[model samples]
Target: MNQDPLQNLRLSHPAHFLALGFGSGLSPVAPGTMGTLVTLPLVWLLAFSGQTGYLLVTLLACVAGVWICGRTARDMGVHDHGAIVWDEVAGMLLTMIAVPVNWLTLLVGFLLFRMLDIFKPWPISYLDKHVHGGAGIMADDILAGVVACGLLHLLIFIGWLPVPAL
Candidate 1:
């Protein structure tokens, strides 16, 4: 009889809890997507603090994620395991920075971030390949968020997407 490998991971551990995206990363499906989806409410709430606060929170998450993800990965004996997704949470927050928190923006930002993260084009791919540890796990998703944020802003600037009055 085969036991589930993840059963050994204790969600009670703070690093494991966070790195697993509050358990959303344990989903049998696309855990990364689930992790990103679970972060939408956080993004919306942070939007109330305005861009500066949002950026600050995102920065903090990114910084802490290095340890959170790294610790969990070490425990799991896998680098950047599919079950660790704090990076996705941080990436989604970064993607939503300065953007109005509405269903549309949320959807677009989620899709864009996921796309960049999944595709890992150019520098993102390069960093993911060369980097290691918690920072290595986060580098690709962070870059994806940055690119998606830029694309999202461009969409609004070009009038392809409207900036709803806040």
Candidate 2:
């Protein structure tokens, strides 16, 4: 693509700032992973308020992300530019829902979410290919989060994944 993802930052658009994960997405390498890493602390902090608070924050983020991502992509004139990583933040937040916020669970959730996102299994792959615009940008990642969440819960149920006392 000829378009520079940084153009919005140069222009100082608020939507670009948020959609870029507050600059984490500007990383030259693995911006999405960087975005998730940046999001971890925010999620950790939110977790202190308990699950209800975490869920509320995550819901708000997801809702805001659709608009932010959409606007940033429009500004960049690119569809789901690699630099727009708010979707990663929302996905990671969704992945962590009810999964406990300890280091181990965070690590597992991150790995699982990244794998499902990268591989894009079945309907996730279908959505990634078929969907468009901001919702499309967010859809596959959200589904990956759902898949990761379910797997984490299953592991907990089987007693394979021990939930550490927070």
Candidate 3:
């Protein structure tokens, strides 16, 4: 008899719960996207805390995610399993840093982050290939977020993407 692959990954486990993006990573399709979407509310909430607070929290999450993701992956006996999406959560948070919290900014940030993450351009692709372990799983997405953040900022600076008055 074959057991379900997810059977061993219990949501009851704190590491599993976090690493899986609070169950968003369990989605049957586009788990990474789902994980990123799940983090939107968090980004919205963090917006109120200002950029410094947002950066601190995102940094903490990324640091903790290394351990949370690594431990969960070890338990599941896989290397950077598709269902481990804490990296996505941290990446999305990084992408939204200092950007306005309005819907347009949120949507643009989401698309930019997701696009870079999916496409893995240049250095992002390099890190994805050369890096290993939990840090490896996270480095690429974080870089994608950084690049996306820069692009978004550029758009705002150029007046291509106007920052709506809050």
Winner by lDDT? 1
State candidate 1's TM-score.
Answer: 0.95
Candidate 2 clashes: the total is: 0
Weakest lDDT window of 10 consecutive positions for candidate 2: 3-12
Enumerate clash totals for all models, in the order shown: 0, 0, 0
Instruction: Give all TM-scores, in the order shown.
Output: 0.95, 0.93, 0.95
What TM-score number comes out for model 2?
Answer: 0.93
The residue-by-residue lDDT of candidate 2 on 1-166, one tens digit each, is 4756566554267788889998898899999999889988987898898888999988988888889898888878888988899999999999988877789888988999888988889999999999898889998988888889899889888998898765
- Pairs clashing within candidate 3: none
Residue 88 Cα positional deviation in candidate 1, in Å, after optimal superposition:
0.3
- Model 3 misplaced regions, further than 4 Å: 1-5
Provide the lowest-lDDT 10-residue window in model 3: 1-10
- Model 2 steric clash pairs: none
Q: Rank the candidates by lDDT, best first.
A: 1, 3, 2
Error of 3 at 151 (Å): 0.6
